[model samples]
Target: MDEAPKALQRFLAPFMEQLTQKNLGNAVELMNEDERNEFDRLLGLATEPVRSFAPYTF
Candidate 1:
């Protein structure tokens, strides 16, 4: 991540916020927001299960 470009980091900010917050349902909700919904949703889905028991359920 340290090597990632600034724009890439900015673009991923929202998804990172949601991931850090551990809001699974918000991932789905985030899909409806503007600003690269595809990327946000993808990352959201990918990171939602951190520190969770249902690691692979979704």
Candidate 2:
């Protein structure tokens, strides 16, 4: 995240915070289509393994 551009970091902050707080549903619900797409793309770039317990209907 520290390596991300300022604007990108700012754009993702709220969703990242929600995820950190374990509020997946809220984060998903709050994202518009574009946001959701970008988030999904970013998730693919994660170095560490990621897991999701619930299916997201994006």
Candidate 3:
């Protein structure tokens, strides 16, 4: 992120905001069953929970 320039960051700000806050269900309501299934599958990958581990000290 440090390498990303301020201009690019400014451009991405609004798109990122929409992505974080948009309701997936509302956006997918018009999709056909197959399209909906594909969306669900992809969304599952993105939403998968990451496991956290406690820090180990030397």
Candidate 4:
């Protein structure tokens, strides 16, 4: 059971990274000040591993 998730995660890792990258790009291009702040707030709670994917900084 544990290995199953690891296997799945390994399989999906590349696609998830690509999608997260694209979404981060789009968020930067489209967000206004208020929206960006909201995004940053939400970002602060994201898991440390992927939070660096955030494309914006205060």
Query: What lDDT does each candidate get?
Result: 0.55, 0.65, 0.52, 0.50
Residues 1-58, candidate 3, lDDT per residue (tens digit)? 3333444444334444656455544455545787666555655555666667858843
**Per-residue lDDT of 11-44 in model 1, one digit per residue for the tens?**
5567568775655465455654565565565456
Instruction: Specify the highest-TM-score model's number.
Output: 2
Off by over 4 Å in 3: 1-23, 53-58
Question: Model 4 misses residue 14 by how many Å?
Answer: 23
Query: Whose lDDT is greatest here?
Result: 2
lDDT of 1: 0.55
Task: Measure candidate 4: CA RMSD.
Answer: 13.9
What is the C-alpha lDDT profile of model 4 across 1-58, one tens digit per residue? 3244445445344435656465455545565677666555545444234334656754
Model 2 collision count = 0
TM-score ranking from best to worst?
2, 3, 4, 1
Error of 1 at 43 (Å): 13
Better of 1 and 2 by TM-score: 2
TM-score of candidate 3 relative to the true fold:
0.43
Give each model a TM-score.
0.29, 0.46, 0.43, 0.39
**What are the per-residue Cα lDDT tens digits for candidate 2 across 1-58?**
4343454556667776767564556677779999888766665554435456766755
Look at candidate 1 and tell me the lDDT of residue 3: 30
